[model samples]
Target chain A: MAVPTTRTARRGRPGYDLESLLRIAVKLFNERGYDGTSMEDLSRKLGITKSAIYHHVSSKQELLRLAVGRALDGLFAVVEEARTVPGRAIDQLEFLVRGSVTVLADRLPFVTLLLRVRGNTKVERDALAKRREFDHIVSALVEQAAIDGDIRADIDPATTARLLFGMVNSLVEWYRPRRDDDLHTIADTIATIAFEGIRLPGGE
Target chain B: MAVPTTRTARRGRPGYDLESLLRIAVKLFNERGYDGTSMEDLSRKLGITKSAIYHHVSSKQELLRLAVGRALDGLFAVVEEARTVPGRAIDQLEFLVRGSVTVLADRLPFVTLLLRVRGNTKVERDALAKRREFDHIVSALVEQAAIDGDIRADIDPATTARLLFGMVNSLVEWYRPRRDDDLHTIADTIATIAFEGIRLPGGE
Candidate 1:
């Protein structure tokens, strides 16, 4: 769910904003971990009252949902946008991979936090469900690519999709965004390794 | 870092063993994060007194070290074994990927626990150091393969290694061992996607 930018858009807080609050919460969540971070800790870090945090969001879980949701939404948006690529499934799959790298670079913290969740809470479970949906979409794209004779048919499509995304998703572990231009290079490297690796010999 | 099988193999407890304790510790750590689980939790899970738990290992951190150490040791052993393979670096790289999949499958819980650590504790930092060492070894091998003209020269070897191992390491998330034979199939799939991905056309 899109977190309302403010409790009410017309009456804006002069000093603290909801987006800033969410950003700090996410940073703390990423650093100390979701379970380890408390609202009181957020208050201490943000130099604001817990009452102010509640005024913006209902609970720590809400912050988590918004943070994790941004990542899932970005990925699903890539999926939906990629659906409109007017070409073979393999082309669309490459677009999906490249777009995902951009989203990850753009929303690194959110995606990093999303990757770390283990379905422990309701929020985590919901995030995981969305992730599974995204995985299914990628797997379907791989199968279609195989049927189109664009990629190797020997590997199981689901496994191929998993391994492909495994490499993509792994960027969250080590990649630190040094430049905006680096995203495309990273995307190309991954796509070249993944798609070209799986592609049949003819298109080369 | 080999955990002595028992305090003494000859004088084993009739009901429990260190292996079983480490296994249970790993399960709980995976289920309810290492930081979240307490000594009391372990004692209750094992149906033993906290004193008994202490008698076996110095502290919870020791359990974590032992647990994560198993994964690192298993991986390093694979690294050492792959070194003896006499072939082009590309061939050896494929062997490393396949052997890693086996290690991950055989030591699923330990490897799972290892991936989740964030270096918050000294034990965790040590584990991360070992992981980096493993990654460095793989990257060096990839560099050699690239220099040997077995793989693509356009991509950076370290990034290639990261992406390759990322795909292999991700098996820990969704892959549950069904049959021992499936391990071979899984390993072949990873090697195909990774090595063939970077392979020169015509296999020259």
Candidate 2:
């Protein structure tokens, strides 16, 4: 795979690093469904030959595995960190929520790809398995929180966890990062709404 | 375009009515994206000739148009009903949340298709525009509710509205309908989480 001299790297991505290559691959996979996108498509988009792409990543499946791995890694890191928080399950849950919003925001493309995985192949199936594991951890937290009288016991903990993360996971869809947007404020709002409720005290 | 006598509609879809055809088409579009799905594929799945399938809907784009229309119309209908609720803005917002959930659950496939549109074509662009209009209406309700001192005014209303609906919209991804699952219980859970929140009263 002869490295193209000039025209291929017109986007200033000439001599692409693995990180840059992975980012572009994830973006393409998200825009075009994993099944819909082809190796030729990725090569063309990257302005490199197919062999050049294969040099960095063994296969398209490897590309997907790497991208979703980055996202899952970010999420699990938060879960691991929250596990050490010194408080009740509610406290850990809040920490997870804040940490997750930061992960989704920081690694939006990778997380977006992770969220869209549909288990079409071995790589996707692994990602889905990891995701279920993550969900189980969250549900356990919610269940423990409910038992401690910290969270509402009226709702099933599993259902409660789904809705809680549903709101936070939604950032990939509509949350465009703006210059002035505050990540802490965003996390604060999620915690506020999730814990304190959005309706004024007397109004509810 | 004479219809074949036998094996085409192996799924018991022989002689598909427009409703049945629309449902199957939406399902296929969801499974294999609209661009990836061919009319021949639909005809093969329906046990009809391509021309016979075309006799019902003018084009695949029409199928997409109709599919997304069903989903958008369901959402708009909820908005209209919410408008008729003679109460505070918070009340209307709650109504919108519940109604939207019903729409999503009842028409899961259509709503799923609606959420995945990426504005690649005229039909998609139109659907995206309608979606924005729907978001604006919901944001207005949130803003008004905040001004009324019913909703906490600290967070931006638009941001709040996005997160609220994000939770509802997520039903398409994970929510599976079972005969024993009560719809009201689900709606109550969403309303409770969005308005009253998940934490116990004194937990904060």
Candidate 3:
């Protein structure tokens, strides 16, 4: 593969392009898992020396940070955009959940790794901290919805938020994007089941 | 610690009791995570040599197998009992969901480890296979419930099962056994929200 003009010489040519390196890293991370992946393994996969990888990124943890940050940035952006939307609390929550699912589906590998990382490394820990902040934002929305009588008040907001994300996070586990499974359809299905629920609201 | 056994070891001593070793192993597995833990770490934690651990179990993978098998057994039993219960499909599913939550809270550490494993080892692979089987069974139940016209037909059964288990699995992420947070109470809350949902029935 040809190195793009953006690359700089660091003693020698960058052994692998940055874009190729990231795609390979994400694939390996998904395959062997984040903790199971090693620098040597990544080098072997990319047909590049370990030094070549170091020239591109400092370490394996740096790769993880780059990958999970992609997912986290997508999620936090959804929360930020949804909060500004003019609607009822439930409507805002609906927009947030649907948009989040679409992001998760689009960035499946990155978000899958993000969800699985248990803070074993600094990168993983930072990802988790940011993840908790996102959860807090969603939980606050659930709290507002509950207070507005848009949602049931019997359950605590934190528990409700956990349940909501639980439903959303499971998307990473089972959502295989088919040629037919468009984001709009997937997001609509998730939102409908989430808001109105699997029970027919009118008479069931 | 004094060796309580009446029989003396032919070697230096009976290094560590099996029960005590298991307790320490489970604790370490929970703390460092299963993939991150090593035999050397386990030995140091037990204050015993690596060879001494081998005297009880062949390998670290054996300990993982034992730990995950205990959790898998609990989950499979819940599904089996649910299958035999005489009721409509939704009722049986409700029973299974509550039972699984109770088992999960009861065996929090083991199930937490089981949930986190990424098929990096043979033991992990086996655990993942069993987990998939359990998911399949639950999906079948979800389908049956939908067919019976209990759950709405619009949402796919597989998706609903994922949503249901997602709610159950999130318990491990945050749930702590507090004085106020009883297991049955939490299980009841999960089932209620899962089935009836957070929406007030009949618009209150």
Interface RMSD of each: 6.3, 1.3, 3.3
Best by DockQ: 2
The residue-by-residue lDDT of candidate 3 on B173-203, one tens digit each, is 7888774677776776677667766655433
Q: Write the residue-wise lDDT of candidate 3 on A1-204 in tens digits.
A: 222323332335445677779878998888767766888788778666677777778788888888898899899889889989998777788889888998899888889988878877788889989988988888888888888887787777777777788878888867888745556766766666656666544323
Give me the chain B TM-score of candidate 2: 0.91
Of candidates 3 and 1, the better by lDDT: 1
Which candidate ranks first by lDDT, i.e. highest? 2
Ranking by TM-score: 2, 1, 3
Q: Give the alpha carbon lDDT tens digit for every residue of A53-156 in model 2.
A: 87788888999999999999999999999999999999999999999999999999999999989888999999999999999999999999998998889997
Model 1 stretches with alpha carbons more than 4 Å out: A1-14, A179-181, A198-204, B1-14, B178-181, B198-204
Worst 10 residues of 3 chain A by lDDT: A1-10
TM-score of each: 0.88, 0.93, 0.84
Give the TM-score (vs. native) of candidate 3: 0.84
Per-candidate alpha-carbon RMSD to the true structure: 6.1, 3.4, 5.2
Residues B1-204 of candidate 1 have per-residue lDDT tens digits of: 233334343244345578989999999998878888998888778766676777788989999999998998899888888889988677677888898898999999999999989888999999999988988898998888767766777887788888888898898888888844477777878878775562324221
Clashing pairs in 1: none
Model 2 stretches astray by more than 4 angstroms: A1-13, B1-13
| Quality class of the docking in candidate 2, CAPRI style | medium
